[model samples]
Target: MYDEILLPVAPVGEANDAITHAVGLAERYDATVHVVSAADTAVDTLAGPRTGAFSERLVDAAEERVEAVTDELEAAGVETVGSVARGDPLEVIENAIEDGADIVVMPSHTRRGIRRLLLGSVTEKVIRVASVPVVTVPMAESEAEGERSDAAVDDVGGASGSR
Candidate 1:
């Protein structure tokens, strides 16, 4: 019944499962996957010029994330459209849904306790507010750990491998 499947991805590598799940569902329904990445510019905007630079970087990263995800989906022979929107993550997603998404498929982090509180769960928020069906793909613990390790290596001047 799905015609457009919305898949929101963060700049993190934890979205592999969600991407794969979306591909499968999109293939089954012959739906076009609209991949979106949010460049969160809502925080620390009082720095003026520096804030503008930072927001630009965020948008660039979000664009790269969308491109990578769309490339993967297209490689799998699934129809895809992608965009990088600058806004709150939830707002970007909500706007995509309003643009005519039939369903949403997204990654759910396993953050708990204080961590979850400090970094609010967008997936949980989407589930609560989205009018369309929300499908959450949980990231495996090992996969999450691997992503963290890769980030650490990248921070130390190591190159990250492709997905």
Candidate 2:
């Protein structure tokens, strides 16, 4: 039922699950995927040139994130295109949805207690505000273990090819 699927990539390990899920769903529906990497850049412009430099860094990272997902989808034979945007996370995603997303596929992390309350989820915010259907994927146990493994490897100055 999806003609245009929008998948937003987060700068975290959990995003792998969302990318995988989105690619699978897109393949099933033969839909073109619109991937977006959003960096929250609502900082005060009073920071002068430093603000511009910071925004550039965010955009660069976002582009890298988007490229990685697009490359994975392309390798899987799925049609995809992507863009990087700067704004509030929810607003950036909502703008993509309004552009032409039939549905949104995203991942949510398991946060609890004080952390969950303090940093409310972007996926939750998007779900609340998005006009289209939202598919929320949770990171699987195996994936979580893999992420831990990857982290351990990184801590010891090792490279992870899993991604």
Best by lDDT: 1
How many backbone collisions does model 2 have? 0
Q: Which stretches of candidate 1 lie over 4 Å from their true place?
A: 146-163
TM-score of each: 0.84, 0.81
lDDT (C-alpha, whole model) for all candidates: 0.74, 0.69
Q: Tens-digit lDDT track for model 2 on 6-95?
A: 988753333457778888888899999988866656543456768677666666766777888888899999999988776666767888
Q: Cα miss at 143, model 2 (Å)?
A: 6.8
Superposed Cα deviation of residue 27, candidate 1 (Å): 0.8
For model 1, name the residue pairs that clash: none
Question: CA shift at 45, candidate 1, in angstroms?
Answer: 3.6
lDDT by residue (tens digit), candidate 1, 1-163: 9999999887545446888999999989999999987766664456566867766666776677788989999999999999877666777889999999999998776767865675456778888999999998877887756655543112101112211
